[model samples]
Target: MDALDDLDLRVSGCRACPRLVDWREEVARTKRAAFADQTYWGRPVPGFGPPDARLLIIGLAPAAHGGNRTGRMFTGDRSGDVLYQALYDVGLASQPTSVAADDGLELYGVRVTAPVHCAPPENKPTPGERETCRPWLVQELRLLRPTVRAVVVLGAFGWQATLPALAEAGWRVPRPRPAFGHGVRVGIDRSEGSVGGGGPAGLDLFGCFHVSQRNTFTGKLTPAMLREVLSTAARAAGLGK
Candidate 1:
């Protein structure tokens, strides 16, 4: 198997965080009222996208009823509804909706991952849990660094998590790292281990508001707002020609 596939297998089997492991399993066993008939993934969710993707999207974590149930990042949730539509509008996704893993929704030049793989209680992972989950993200970035030209961080949490992971994956992040804000952009020097291994000098990072229900329902994040950010990043990543 390829490195990405092997890493995904390892990620799926991880039970390093006791709290996360228990919570995820319990949720799966109990099942949500609306999804009681469906089986849950009940484990660490792996990143999804083409192996050669140039656009990387970093989200906070799997939603309890979304990824934790569907086993695909950003699937089966309101947040995903907003996100996938924007990606579709910008020509990144083949379809505007991602209802399930086998629904045939495809991302053309992008990959989606999260800092925390497992769903957390109250939709928030504790600081210790976030730290424990860091290694997986660090390793994933190491694998993607070469091909990834641009990264879109979905929220401040993802922003904070990605900067360190990028550094650990050998990117030279700025010392004072730029603050996160909607449409914020930062450039970081890529190291020798990157995909091209020689010429490409840097990677661009873009920040966007999280597509959570709170944001979408409150008008804090609209389709046009998200499309603008994604389209710009996609262009920077050399996608959507």
Candidate 2:
């Protein structure tokens, strides 16, 4: 397989964080009452999308019963319901729902990933765990740097995590770093200089509230709001033309 495939395979096998490994495996074995008959992936979830994508979406981490069970980022959860529907509405995704890894949902020119690959307890990954998982994201960003033109970071946690990874991947994150805010957009330039003589390739970074039940249920993030952000980022990535 290629570099991305290799990276993904490696990601799926990671057990670097003892806490996350224990939590994820326990959750998998216990099995949610609704899904008792189903088998859980119970491993580090890999990034989902084509290798050379133009748009990247960053999330905090997998939900305990969501990605940890489905084995795909943003799958089998209410959060995924909001995210996928918005993506589909903006013409970035082939389907309006993401239930399973084998669901056949396709993302056009976009990839989805997280700072922490495994689901964390109480949906919160410790700072140490986040750091431990950084290498995988750093490598994934490097692999996508040539083609990725824009990124949409969901939630402040993802926004904070991704800025450092972006800098490590070749982009020059601004001094003071951009603050995370819904509907925020920042332009980042390549620190290493031009790409294909393209005069210092840059990337568009957009921020959106997390599509968690807390946000959606409270109307902190509406369908229209989510779509607007995705559409804007999709256009920046030269998609939907």
Candidate 3:
């Protein structure tokens, strides 16, 4: 509750990334006629899951009508719909739907969050924007301390953002590790924390092509592809059924 409470406050009026803030606000303003009464929360979106979550799902920025509209990470988007369905299949999520705030979705031990909170114009965030958005991620990781067993990065950028934290926490990569693809897993030696007593544990990082239209339409990512990654992460996190 402590960490979640702090994150809620931190995300309320976030201005860490000026470019994203300005762009998000502009988009909200220009489309105000239609969404004015909708209460656009053009602020940092917080992670959703358990305080002692064992799995971390990393994604890119929110979409215009996705998390940006629903105010919950990954909600109200095609990507989220697919993701939640997969999580439901793996026994992590109770609902196969994540369409809106009232979807009543619940994650067992999985947390979902985006690299960038504010939805960028055209869904592409600049490198400067990514840099500006890094701090919140760092803070989030710190608060998530002991329970994280593996991080399932949804794309290249998500992997990149998570790598440094893994490194500083004493994680190491093996030689000839392949680039991100569906069902790729890399185990890292980490010193973040253990269940209770402070100790070292291996953090498994699984990578998959994002569930975006670009990948899904091209068949680069499919339900089978994503499910493989999910199974791998679950096995690593000791959540296997």
Candidate 4:
């Protein structure tokens, strides 16, 4: 198996965090009423996309009834619905809907992942949990570094988590760090010490509001806004407009 595939297998088998392990298994057993007949994946979700993807999208932890149930990042939830649709509109995804792992949907030049793989209670992973789960992200970043040139981070949590992982994976993250805000973009170089920006081989980091029900339902993040962000990031990743 390829390194990315092997890493994914390891990630899915992770049971390092006691609370997450118990909670994920419990949620699987209880089974949401709407999906009672369906079998939950009940394991940590892994990054989904081609290993040579030039663009990467980072999100918060998987949703309890979403990735935790479907075994794919950003699948089986309203958030995924919003995200995949935007990706499709921008030509980054084959379809606008991501309902299940084997649904035949595909991403073009893009990969979707998260800082935390497990479904945290209330969608909030504790600080300790994030730290415990970070090695997996670090390893994934290292593996993707050769081709990944741009990143779109959804939400403040992902932004905070990704910077450290990026630094550890060989990028020179700016000091005082870049703040998280919709439409914010920061350039990161492969070497440390200098932080001018827009280096030829550097990575571009774009910030976007999370595609959560809260943001979408309140119109804080509209379809047009999401598409704009995805399109801009895709272009920066050399995926064409």
Q: Provide TM-scores for the models.
A: 0.95, 0.96, 0.88, 0.95
Cα lDDT computed for each candidate against the true fold = 0.91, 0.92, 0.76, 0.91
Tell me the lDDT of model 1 at 189: 83
Clashing pairs in 4: none
**lDDT per residue as tens, model 1, 55-112:** 9999999999999999999999999999999899888899999999999999998999
**Residue 134, candidate 3: alpha-carbon lDDT:** 72
lDDT of 1 at 182: 98
Candidate 2: segments with Cα more than 4 A from true spot: 193-200
For model 4, residues 156-192, the per-residue Cα lDDT tens digits are 9999999998887778899989999999999998764
**What is candidate 3's CA lDDT for residue 30?**
60
Residue-wise C-alpha lDDT for candidate 2, range 123-173, written one tens digit per residue: 999888888999899899888877999999999988878988888777888
Residue range with the least summed lDDT across 10 consecutive positions in model 2: 192-201
- Give the higher-lDDT candidate: 2 or 3: 2
User: Where is model 3 more than 4 Å wrong at Cα?
Assistant: 32-37, 169-178, 192-200
Please provide, for model 3 over 1-241, each residue's C-alpha lDDT reduced to its tens digit, 9 standing for 90 to 100: 4866687678757887777788777765565455566766556677888877888899988877677777788887788888988888888898899977777888988889877788888899877777677777766765665677888999998777777655544445554544776567777765544433564456788888898988888888888888878877977787745
Query: Whose lDDT is greatest here?
Result: 2
